[model samples]
Target: MNGARGKRRFLLALCALAALLFGALGVWQVELPCQTLDLIERVDARVHAPSGPIPPRSSWPRINAKSDEYRHVLVRGRFLHDRETLVDALTERGAGFWVITPLRAAEGPILINRGFVPRGRASPSSREAGQVAGEVTVTGLLRLTEPGGRFLRPNDPAGNRWYSRDVAAIARARGLPGAAPFFIDADASANPGGLPVGGLTSYRLRKRLLDVALVIMTSPVTVPLTILGALLVRITMGAPVLFVQSRTGVSGQPFRMYKLRTMRPLAPSEALQATSAGDVRITRVGAWLRRFRIDELPQLLNVLKADMS
Candidate 1:
């Protein structure tokens, strides 16, 4: 039939586009999955090693989450108890505050995340014993500063309320002219007062290599299906056959997720927060795509693109 011939031609065009994309993006991404186990073992060795010297200020600018974050490091400094900031936290111990205090180290002032203190013991007076006044040695994991506040809730420096541990914001608020851009999460060396608990950081390394393998293995069926789906979307809807969504990835990085457009454009007055199942914005074609979960096919490309989430 004429319709079948059109579909074959459309598929060839889609294949050409995919080939161009692969050529541009460097498509052989299956190496990571094969090396994932080896990578995990290597990371474990580095993470569990004995405390080492903190990266000097000269090299701070070169520090990165990939090479330096979570490395065990040592620093000796006097705690500036008065300048300590408490950021809201929820740990295994329950809802509490992370006591982020400035340490006057020889290199410079660096923030030390003393640890979580329960809500009832959030006041400094309640955990007085842990607040050592004299010079002390802190041996713990070095952490990269989390800049922007947590999701939806931004830090209020004026009001002294912090939802996340932002280094620059805290430094400005506490009047530290020169402070390190990173912080240290103190190890679980028992504090005298036993209020703020340390060494509660969790390290979860995602294994996205298998995602690459899966996509490569299923490409035969998936490639054709994706092209077919795109064609269907174009015929059913109008222009802009793909819907792109912004999502958070590893270490608060933003990524664009691709999917076949299923819903009609929403009106300006519509709520952007949530879309209900019965919402009028859902087109008949979109409803069908949702029912069969065909809209997820395009995400196979996300796996190839170094982010599988």
Candidate 2:
């Protein structure tokens, strides 16, 4: 009787533990949407406001990311493209570099993220047609300076390989001592030759959070299915259970989409070619996953971070 009672207690304890975990998870999940909505409301108001003069130098010290970032502003200045820094960036077009140029204005010099340019077009001479010489009025969203590099990697100014747009670091390196602490992302206006593409930043973050919440709330079922499918792919396909490729999203923006690995990696020349009905690269297991629509399971995580609804 004691043994049976102990067994019953053990099962009850296990059930209680699971209930506790689920309760905690539910609370966190519920709070995330609320936080996301609050963030969107605050930022959307600032973004939709009319373009105004940039914060004066006196307010520079008080500038911060919380309230000031993403504010629309206008600056009239001459772009000093010669000292422009090309920071590595990954956009809808593909992996490329951002053209960070300093604009000489009356208030002071400020960095302007001109836009994304592929490696071949990164050279200033390549896009000389778009380089406006005289004082031009530029309007866009302001962004806080990124410091300490990205993803635990430090900015290598010595080698001219910058990972983040650290305002102070970039200014000191470019010899612009009084450069503004913030930079502006140029609007999606087409340049003469359309070399560096602008206006890639998405403001639809509200939809993004809801989309992610949808994915997370279904985690109990999706997570297990994903793990099972991944294991099956790994076992059948040797290695590389996931395939990543760049695809265009809403508003003609490029984003990397994810899916279960169902085929071999394509060669550079063959990348433009699409997979057909009887493509040899698609493995037997991959075909089954595709038939059951299991290959798309990985895309749910994309909704979590890629601002794709």
Please give the RMSD to the true structure for each candidate, in Å: 5.8, 8.1
Judge candidate 2 against the unseen true structure and give its global Cα lDDT, from 0 to 1: 0.80
For model 1 the local lDDT of residue 240 reads: 88
Cα lDDT tens digits for candidate 1, 1-309: 999999789778867886775554344334543465455555566569998999989998899877887788999989999999999876657778999999999999999998889889988988788889899999888888888786566899999989889999999999997899899998888888785788776422224445555776676567666766776788677678898998864424357889988887666776374878786787888887778778888987877775553
How does each model score on lDDT?
0.79, 0.80
Check candidate 2 and list the clashing pairs: 92-254
Worst 10 residues of 2 by lDDT: 201-210
Candidate 1's error at 158, in angstroms? 2.2
Give lDDT tens digits, candidate 2, residues 19-115: 6766776786678657766766777787778889999999999998787988989999999988899887766687789889999999899999988
Give each model a TM-score: 0.67, 0.66
State the lDDT at 303 in candidate 2. 73
